[model samples]
Target chain A: MTALAERPYGGSRGGPQGGSQGGSQGGRRSRGALALMLPALVPVLVFSVGPLLYGILLAFTDARSGRNTETSFVGLENFAELLSDGDFWESFRIGLVWGLSVTVLQFLASLGLALLLNQDLRLRGVARVLAVVPWAMPPVVIGLMWRLVYHPDAGLLNGLFGTRVDWLHDFSLALPAVIVVGVWTGMPQTTVVLLAGLQNVPKELYEAVSVDGAGAWRRFWNVTLPQLRPVIVAITSLDFVWNINQFSLVYVLTQGGPGGRTRLPMLFAYEEAFRYGFFGYAATLGVAITIVVLAVLGLYLWRQAREAD
Target chain B: MTRALKHLALLGYVVFLAFPLLWLLSTALKTPQEMAALDPTWIPRRPTLANFADAFGEQDLLGAALRSLVVAVATALITVTLALPAAYALARHRSAAGRIAIGWVLVSQVFPVVLVIIPLFMVLRRLELVNTLAGLTVVHVTFVMPFALWMLRGYVRAVPRELEEAAAVDGAGRLRALAAVVAPLLAPGVVATLLFGFISSWNEFLFALVILKDPEVETLPLTLVRFVGPEGVARLGPLAAASLLATVPSLVFFAIIQRRLRSGLMAGAVKG
Candidate 1:
């Protein structure tokens, strides 16, 4: 279904409307198209693209968050200071760990749930609705709901286990605890996408494999995994990007507490710019992290594309 | 035995997915004393409407909600209005610029928000739009624009060119054909995009946190976060109640999209 949905619209237009166009006629039509595009283009240029370019430039200047502060170009100074900034390094490492682990775990769990929901099972209707319910939730609310679960004394986790662990404040436990919530929060969309992919898999291939005396495991291993590869690559990379830049969820959950154990890159950048007022340095951090994330994503996608061939 | 095991596994997944929500519902209903209990029951012993009442009365939740509603509605309407024609152009009239527009949408999604928000703050401050709902609304509209355009483009592509061509043959101009033939066909997609924009703006926190630093101008998500005080148990019920209230719009959105997904108009929207 997703594969069909993703098919581009360029090839299918072959009619009186698509052809029989004169050169001058095509030029006039394109002019009209450009005029139609202008209203949306203006705001996107002024607000989105302009800010992004200016932000990269701001990384090299001494732009503090106050007026009367003279801004000057300080090329490599912020980067130099960032090199020795142990807190920034810690947060970067934590961000990678959080992003990678949560994404991997979320993919695995969602795959299992998606496969289960794809089955001809009872209560499928009820379970399917419950599965995607989290996608409807606000991130802040998901964080708060998990916070309630992970609370020390009166929380549900403690009550369920009859234990008294302060999950969010315990230095060693905080990251893992928050990672659980991350996995849970991201499962719904991942599951939905995977389920869509699963539904698109050819049933006849499974039947053929079954006739060859292949068991359930063999059929799934031979058919499902390869068929779902494109979707897996797309979703995991997207999930990684979303998880690493995540702010509001962890902000509400732990606020990067327990001595910055769960301080993802965005939270670290947020604290730097908003909490401590280091606009230039924070912009540098933001630019640096983006470069790293893109590099990682590029490498991953390149490998996946190679594998797909 | 294998069938039983599969059922058990499915049940386990359901419980894992639903338990936290049930816990939230239970917590929202419990009294302060029940909340403070060392052994919190899965079901509240004496459920009350007190927490909902308290949450409503405690903060300026209504004002924040109104602000959030205004921002979301404006963002949705403006985003769809701008996106519709652009989407039509991209779909029906392909150009190099259209390809570039799609590239921008994908690039915008991958880039970190920090990189954009810092310079945007400076821009807003220069215009003296900081701490204003209009500023936040502008930011929300732009933030949701790329995806809105992308999604609407898919919807536009779904409406066959033949319909518009037939309308053109009937002596209608391009704009008339669009209004008369394509717009009605694109209604479901437009609504989906609008609700998508509305929900995105409504649930937004990081931008609102930065832009609306003045508490008087805080949105619902910001105000909801404030319900989390240092004091723990006493504030739990009201926080739970308020959190639930904050989620109503999104739930309504999900309900609409769920129905659309069943009918097949929302597959591209979900992918976006």
Candidate 2:
């Protein structure tokens, strides 16, 4: 933290200068600050907000793909279809399963790795970057790598283990296989966040508890858990959001195949819009996915707010 | 756990983490017959570079890679240029409007990229950027700017505002004060954000896949995904070769600068 403000003039020169700035200067500067903000706001509104509002409008229309389909206004027809659609509901349920499995498992494994890395081990620097290899890889590449490994023939998983299992194609194993890769590629962010959180926990708390005859587990429970709650909350919330929308990996790995068992909501929507020429219906799916993601975020913020109170 | 056990566990992690890349390397070097051999050797008994020759020669990925590079560079340049001023405002003003902007950016992160695609595609179509690298770069600017701005905000906050004030007190103009005082200290964030924006644009697939219909305009990721058609999975050797080629730049970049990235993120976490 000190590295940020480690300027030579920080402590000594700051106070004397503030006194010379008159009230009139402050007013002009605040307006100038707003002017400084203008460029970013313009693009954010144009590119981000404008497209988003247009997307929401698109969801309520009959904007199907291909030349034969006409673009006409429809009031929640897409949504009503989604409500009764069996495949859509199935994907939603699987989306929750996929999101929870990846997020929860990713968080636990990252915490464990973070704790290990925090220790003064041999080759600590090497281990740190090694763990990040998968995280740094593009999902398309990672998905392909695993695709080769999970092959039933000429495959390492089967070759090394002496078993025959089609990891990506099997009905029961595909989702789990996808989730395992999800944890592998998603670990670095959580580890970095938790490690950052771990540093904030004071050494004296552990020392004082040790003197009171507290064991390692007790110190961890009393000192570590309480201190890391907010960070944990933030990281897991992000993990859930990320995992829920995961598409490219699954798309490359299985394309939501084996009867759509591993099809995430994003993949489902992508297939709908692009594959089946159902652009309007796909827009509804996208909105539904957003609502679920926003709900997850909303719940986290609410809980955090309550905790702060 | 005992210290020996701890070291052993670390070894396990290293092996587990390194295995896939190792396997990929082994595959990339193996002969086509060896890849199809009943008993695949862990080590390619006779290594070959023919697959890479095929990938670069026949598939012509060099052109696709060059296209990816142009898009990545453009995305990084535009994102950093815009993000610097916006992040500066958030760091300096701390007004109610700034808070709302930050919140809005965070909320945008959770919104599905799919939602952005349809509308973004229409806009790009209208502008005739559908298959153009320029269009892909513009779309990436929107996708990447929010996170870049947020991270830059943290880095900007870490810079002491007084340093700029001290320059302004010397009768320097506002732009001159920023160029002199803030820009140098802003180096770490800029470099980090640049790498981030570059890597992200290089790796982006969905929008590029949608917007760029013609093979001539395809980026690296978009071209790579084409290997999975009805032809028995692009032949493992060529696939592995292409993947490794695509993998090196971002992986090396991450290994080098992850510490700076972590510290910047932690600073942001501390504030939140």
DockQ metric, candidate 2: 0.52
Query: How much lDDT does each candidate structure score?
Result: 0.84, 0.82
Show pairs that collide, candidate 1: none
Model 2 chain A weakest lDDT span, ten residues long: A4-13
Per-residue lDDT for A143-192 in model 2, tens only?
A: 88888788787678888888889899899999999988888889888888
TM-score of chain A of each: 0.94, 0.90
Q: What is the interface RMSD of candidate 2, in Å?
A: 3.1
Query: How would you class the docking of model 2?
Result: medium
